[model samples]
Target: MLALKAENISKQYRLGEVGTGTLSHDLNRFWHKVRGKEDPYFKIGEANDRSSKGNSDYVWSLRDINFEIEQGDAVGIIGKNGAGKSTLLKLLSKVTKPTTGKIFTNGRIASLLEVGTGFHPEMTGRENVFLNGAILGMTRKEIKRKFDEIVDFSGVERYIDTPVKRYSSGMYVRLAFAVAAHLESEILIVDEVLAVGDAEFQKKCLGKMGDVTKGEGRTILFVSHNLPSILQLCKKGILLEHGLLKESADISTIISMYTHNAESEDIIPNSNKDVYLKSFKSYTEDDLESNLQTAKNGVLEFNIYSNKNLKNVKIGIGFNDDMGNRLFTPFSGHFQKMFDLSIGENTIYCTLDNFPLKSGKYTCEIYIGDNTETLDYYDKGLIVNVKDNFTLEKPDYSQGYFIINQKWTNERK
Candidate 1:
């Protein structure tokens, strides 16, 4: 059975200022409505590309997006930062109406789109739990039954009676998620609310969500930037780009496409005024540029383009899996090494030794700093691909991120 379905849904917003700045445009829409004709501005909406300005005054935040999610299935929504992710959630949650489409859902929905989304700040956490439960059409008896479970899961028992306005952001998300998850809603919508919580709490929340879907067989729609969490929780995934539904598939395939799109952009912003990074590259042992993927043992070189330089410069690079987990970071300070550069140009090199990390695409961060301050930093400066030079028999070898270097030997079983 289908739990939710969006049909030809689209949301359009007027550029600059609010709603049809001129009376003429407003009158035109009314005239069309009166004549039972299409609105004059309906066809003028441009695609939502924030990189450049458009000629039209209207742009579609989401255009003709269609998908259906089944009951008892968890679906993950993945997209860029401004890819209408929140907009779609808002539309589904009934916080706003679509400009031109319909969304169908089979059961009651409880949403925690943001911190304290459906919460009243002045109300105590205890009262808010009941209030949210009531809003979800739960009886006071039902809420009372789940009250202890909710408080235990949130780990905010001490502050349950305190007014939520005084609670920190993390506390707000904790209690809010607790209520949403424990309530008797058939479909739950969560939108990156776990990000505000601590790492331990985030892990707890993911575990609870897994139980909600797998054990109790509830439908869940989750939006998050944490790729690993999404992979663990959701079986199906959808990718959105510039307000359009680009791809829908299993979680792994969707993530692969999304990362490829991001890497293709190759965006490295130079926020440093003094020293700028011209190029960051990985090379083979024989000295060849291998940016995409290379063997475990290779060289990572950074070419610095500077107007002027000084002494005691420190550099470092960090490697992270796609899920934002830091595998390892090597800093020059580890070896008590520093460099002195000339006036116009500089080059820095970092080498790897038998790095048998599992074969997959990884992202690296480059930073240049002095003892006192940082001269340049790129969060995702480059994408490093590690190839599996030594293939193993087991499939888990391909899935593992880190390789064991120790040799295995045994006399008998």
Candidate 2:
């Protein structure tokens, strides 16, 4: 059965650079409301701010995104930031109304868009639980029945009576997630709210989510920036790009496509300083150039150009799988050496012959640090793809970050 269906859904928003402009837009909307006329800006006949010098029109956050999910399917929504993942979820959760199209759902939806969402800081944890439950259409008797279980599961029983404003950040998350999980809704939609807590809490949340899918017949829509968690928890995947549904497929194939086609121009900066990263040129094999992707067990030679004399300068490289887990980290620190270069121009080269890694995608992070801390960091120093031609024994669990050649002998079972 189709638990949720979004048909030709689209959302549009107007960009306002100045604060005073909002009053004019509000008045226009009010006048349109009184006249029984539709908002003229409903149609997305607007240019993006990036392409135009000064254009005032609507920008589409989602454009005709159409999909349906069956009951009991755990679907992962994957995309680069600003790919309209959150916008779709918001529309589904009914936090914001869609500008066009319709959404059909079989049952109530419980969404955890952000930590402490739907939580009242002034209210006690216990009170908020009941408040949220009531908002989800639960009866007082129903909430009372699950009250202790929720408190115990959250591990916040000690502060259940305290106002949420006084609760620690972790405590607030625990209580909030507990309410969402135990609400017994037909569908659950969770965003990247798990990134804030400690690893143990994250594991607990993942385990609870897994159980929610396994033990209950509920449908789940999960959105996250962490690809590994998505792949591990979701069997089906949906990819979004530029507010459009790009593809829906198996998790593995979807992740591979996302990483390979990932681009940096989509990044929005929190500050101007964040947008201007320090620039440095790199080369390979005595050539002054960039872009390196070497084969497995092949030699990798590097040369870096820098103007300032860097302190505690260490040349390092690491190997990561498609999900961005560091499988290996090799650094010049192992050699107990540091670079003290002369000011102005300097160049250095290092060679790694027969690198110890199986065929996969890996990234090298270069750093220059002082004795106190890192002065500069370059995350994408090198992006390498390793290829191996020889046939090798594969492990039973070959999906980890690396492939190590380990000997195995099994007795008769």
* TM-score for each of the candidates: 0.79, 0.73
User: Which parts of model 1 are misplaced by more than 4 Å?
Assistant: 19-24, 264-289, 292-296, 299-349, 362-384, 388-413
Model 2 lowest lDDT segment of ten: 268-277
* Model 2 regions more than 4 Å off: 17-42, 46-54, 263-326, 331-352, 362-384, 388-413
TM-score of 2: 0.73
Candidate 2 lDDT over 1-413, as tens digits, reads 99999999988776653322377777987899899998766653442224345444567778888898999888999876777888899999999889789999998888888878899999999999999999888999999998998999899988999999998778888888889888978889988777667668877887788888878978889987666567667888899886788888887777667766453212222222211123332223333333322322333343334455556666565555554567776677788767765554345445544444655545545555546765444453134655443455444336544444445778655
Give the alpha carbon lDDT tens digit for every residue of 156-201 in model 1: 9999999999999999999999999999899999998788898799
Clashing pairs in 1: none
Question: Whole-model Cα lDDT per candidate?
Answer: 0.82, 0.69
User: Model 1 scores what on Cα lDDT?
Assistant: 0.82
lDDT of 2 at 66: 86
